[model samples]
Target: MKYIVFFIGLTVVLLFFFSSCSDSNSDHENKTEPGIQHESMKAKTVGIDFAGHDFFQPVSNSISHIHGIGYPNNQEALFIATHHGLKVYSNGIWYETKEHNHDYMGFQATSEGFYSSGHPEEGSTLLNPLGLLKSEDFGKTIEKVSFYGESDFHHMSASYYTPSIYVVNTVPNSKLGTGLYYSLDGGEVWMQSELEGLPQASAHSLATHPRLAKIVGISTPEGLFLSHNNGNTFSLISEERSIGTFFIKDESILYVTADGEESLLEQSLESDDTKQIPLPTLSEGDSILYLAVNPLHEQEISFGTVAGDVWRTEDYGDSWSNILEKGNVP
Candidate 1:
């Protein structure tokens, strides 16, 4: 598998995209008060604000195992989920968490905070395969949603405005089947999609509409497929083989594709109109892995590559500034 897990650092894409014009569907909200079986959480030795501002010493080593990226704190900070913990990039400086370093898999970032699933670090007492969880106060605390100690949803997506969740289960578990399943009422009930028009080939990437309930974009070796009826059926929208896909707007999407040369494109969902965006050149064999479009400012875009390189374009890709170079703190 080329792109193994979402690690959604965005929509956690917020996997590459996710908000809304309607009332939010986020019913399974976590709280600081004792409510949702947070028996395993232990006070960390480190103080709050792990490697946050006032401690802007640049990391000298290479940053690896980046799960994904997102625009948290209302597009003011960029949070990078990794195998170790969460890394923050703000004001052109990078920082790391002091204690909370759980390998955040299936990470999705929203305006409020983020939703993620993964396992605890080596000595941590949290569940081995942490179930779906959410955090509103940065990485300071977390709230359990569902499937605690039962599942680690690496392939997942959630609507930005509502609590609609989707995942492609790898195996049959006590609560879900081995296929694509989504829940509208939090995680209480899950519905498996028919995926009627999806290609027989394996899906490479997935994206969900930030607002729309039943819209999903599945990328395959064949092309990109759009399902409007909650994966009940699909239609091929693009023929170009894409590596990563992210929804930038309700009717437009940003994606990465490489043939002889790498390319970034923003295509309209309703038609074939696509405008190519300029991307900083990548090293050989390194391509973009994830994208995060600012929900507040659609003109601004950022992306990370397999080599741990992060870049941002403030003028709609007309120009770009390198935030991280091959995971190196520049």
Candidate 2:
């Protein structure tokens, strides 16, 4: 009888231990990490058709993990941020900025000059100190601005109508404060803006309408924020979602992309109203990274993804056509 009881007790203990282990593993899979979420992502072959012009015909040299994209005024040049430095595409020619070895994180161009921000070096100085570079002759050369010191910049946007004013988002270190900084004299000087009503979140994207200088939008990890008084104050516009890109066609219409999702959101900037526009769905393994909209036409926009997918939308975000597939145009 003693042997029988002991055997039964051992069986019960083994069953309980296995059940607890299985439950723990299940919980671990369901939990999400900070600043990251799990979702169904895919990569697909695509092309970009813009106003009867196909931009995917030209074979690209290499897609160097683009960090930002901009088109300057009075020139048919496309500026792209790369890990090595800034790359410029003008009149079917490509040029790279010299003497800068930092990773270009964001870019903003104006009639007088262009601005880019990134880390001075990778790894040890990512948050402690960051660098901002400026160029005048279309990425031929660059100069470092002396206003802000050692601040990690995440995103930057220049005013198209008002080129003198620019905004940058920085991650404050334990020694330096974190917030939005505005430059008025073409990045010659910078001042910390008052972010009273905006969420205390790091910014991922910054965009300013061509017509509305006072209205500016920012994409942050927490959500989206908009400022009407030129960064004096801000208001929360979207809930907690990772915003990768933001574009404002007019004073009333806005578009944004959420991280880990292929769907684009079209919202009314005048009020608290929004509508989701369907985009060309990515394959089962792709994820979008950034998006850009043409200033001349509200209906035309472009987006880049992790799968090296470049897509363009002629009818806004209602429909999309692929421009380049993975490894098609680097």
Tens digits of per-residue lDDT for model 1, 1-330: 235532211111212112011111122333343223443444322123434434233454678877778865455667788887788776667877666678887777765567787777778766556677777666667778776666766767776666677886653456765678888865668888887767666556777888886888777666678888888888988765754545546778787764446678888988978888888777788777778887776777888777788888878998898888877887
lDDT of model number 2: 0.52
lDDT of each prediction vs. the true structure?
A: 0.68, 0.52
Q: Candidate 2's error at 228, in angstroms? A: 1.7
Task: Determine which window of 10 residues in candidate 1 has minimal summed lDDT.
Answer: 16-25
Q: Per-candidate TM vs. native?
A: 0.82, 0.64
Candidate 1: deviation at residue 182, Å?
A: 1.0
Where does model 1 exceed 4 Å of error?
5-61, 240-243
